[model samples]
Target: MKLLIVTPHFYPENFKVNDMAFELQKRGHDVSVMTAIPDYPEGRFYKGYGIFKKRRESINGVKVHRSLIIPRHSGSSFWLAMNYLSYTFFASLKSLWFGIAKKYDAIIVHEPSPILVGIPAVIIKKLQKIPVHFWVLDLWPESLTAAGGITNKNIIYPFEKLTKWIYDNCTTLMIGSKGYEKSICNKGDFKDKIEFFPNWVEDSLESQKMIDVPKLPKGFNVVIAGNMGDAQDLPHIMETARMLKGSNIRFNFIGDGRKREYVENYARENGLMNNIFCLGRYPLEAMPAFFAQADILFMALKDTPIFALTVPSRLQAYMSSGKPVVAMINGEGADTIREADCGWSVPAGDSEQLANLLKHLSTLNKDELTQKGANGKEYSRKYYDFTKCINHLEKIIGTGL
Candidate 1:
């Protein structure tokens, strides 16, 4: 089977879709993914790549076609919209012209935001008579509004209509959480086509089995890793760090995004320099060792209704690393941790509540923490491993073909 994957984020961008495509290829399917050059979240081009014109290459045996795009930082909504639109246009044109000869059996379009890439997949699927699957990373318009990225009355209606159109047209739509299905199905009026497909943790490929955990800071380490954007409400975490000062616990934020400067500023103002450490963005490959080094893993999100239906990808990674999580988040993400017995969750944005929860963590014995971590690791291996997740995806692709 020939599989064509259309996503704005792919190889060299530290997105999971890269490993996904590789898994598909290893399964004996001919898989090729088309994407823009490796500029994401920051909108800056990677060190060696250029924008404008398509570049073709292969990474670890998977065929890749990189199209030109107007890169913009994730925090800047206007430029980000332009960036997605430009990639949507050029990738569609270039793929149709240069890639049609391969005759794809099925097309998978990853929907991170805006449905830009999915629109192109819809066109190609309609013209070529191939089945198209739209994978929802996050529910769009709603998520955009939740993140305060865009709320203009003039554009909201059109964007919502476009989202409904894409959902209506795709042969199948895969959402990352069960909590998201109802919202998407309601919007698209296509309940039969929507499938619950949570993001999985491919631990062996993405993380190293700890021979031994690395040396921690002077106190117990509570590490939060991944993007520091508005959606995460990192300020609350900073406040929690301040509250933990002089205690036997410290906070380390090991990722970067729009809120990086804000977090740094807050740490400085609160005199948390010794208690909180900000490690800039590290590549996806280097994350596992860092995860192993932590005494507790942290996850949080802004207080928004839409977030109730969302789960951040980092949760899977954190759980798979055999670390107990402290989730100051809402809804599906919180539910997952609760169900797995892997962590504790407090309401979003309440630093006092989060701080108290952190304090409770301090009371847990090493054996209890290890038990929770082990439970999470076991659950991830059995239910949320990429091997299992992608196998389900492959079956869907095969059925479509």
Candidate 2:
């Protein structure tokens, strides 16, 4: 099988696309990625990446084609638009000029963002008559408003239409959460073909090396990994840490995002710096051991209806680490944690209840924590294994593997 995985975010940016591409390549499919320069979470271009010079290279047996992009986004909504539009626009041109020319049995557009990333896939689908599956990670229009990226419905009208076109045109739509499925279908016409496809941790994460791992500062660590955006309500987290001032629990935040400054500043100014360790971002591979070092894994989201459907990719990572979770979110994500008996959960934005849960967790003995962690790992194995996930995805894609 020959596969073309299209995405704006890929290697060096730590998107799930990396794991999927490698899986396809490992399975004997000639997989090639069409992506722009890496600039995400951090906003600026990474080392060895540039705006102009287009390049192609082989990464771990998979061929990768890079395209030019306006690499300035991450923090502000203005730059966020530039980041999305710039990648979609140029990458579309790149597809027409180069990417679409390749012979591909199937096209898989891995859209963790910007529905427009599927533009190239649409062109390839129409021109070559190949099937293109759009794996939508986030719902547009609603997400734009949720992220405070775009609020004006008048200005968002065209984008709304665009979203409908993309949804209607794709061969199949894959959504990670039932929340996304319900919301997306309500917006337009996609109720028939949509399938549930939660993101899974790569099978490789199970083999985290035991030695020479990254060290934590001190205290019982309750770590939250992944993006630190406003959607996360990180200020609330800072306040949670503030409330737990004299406790043994230290809130450690890994990964970078727009509100990271707030996390740092609030921790420092409020005299809780030692209690809150903003360890920042690290590579995806390092996450297993890093998570294993923690006493409990943390998850939080804003008090939005859409976010209730949200489950961060890092949740899978945390589950894979076999650590008990302490979640502060609503809806499906919290339901999953509770169902798995993985850990405890309080409602989103409830600092007092959250503090109470942490206190209760602290009272639990080591053996109890270990059992909860084991349950989470077992649940992850049954549900969050990429091997099983991709098997289902390939069937839905109907590429005839």
For 286-378, candidate 1 gives per-residue lDDT tens digits of: 667777778899989888888888877888888888889888898988998998999889998889998887888887798999999998888
Please, what are the lDDT tens digits per residue for candidate 2 over residues 1-401?
88889998788677788988987788778998999888786878888878554367788898888877776565687787788888888788877765445788888999877778888888777777877788988877777777675778897888788888888778788888877888888777788868888899875567756535568877788888888888887867777888899788888887888888888888878898678888877766677777777899998888877788777676777777889998888998898888889888889898888988887887789899998899889988998888888888778767435
User: What value of lDDT does candidate 1 attain over all alpha carbons?
Assistant: 0.80
Best by TM-score: 2
**Cα error of candidate 2 at position 129, Å:** 1.8
Give the clashing pairs for model 2.
Answer: none
List the candidate 2 regions with Cα displacement exceeding 4 Å.
52-54, 399-401
> What TM-score number comes out for model 2?
0.94
Q: What is the TM-score of each candidate against the true structure?
A: 0.93, 0.94
RMSD in order of candidates: 2.3, 1.9
lDDT of each: 0.80, 0.81
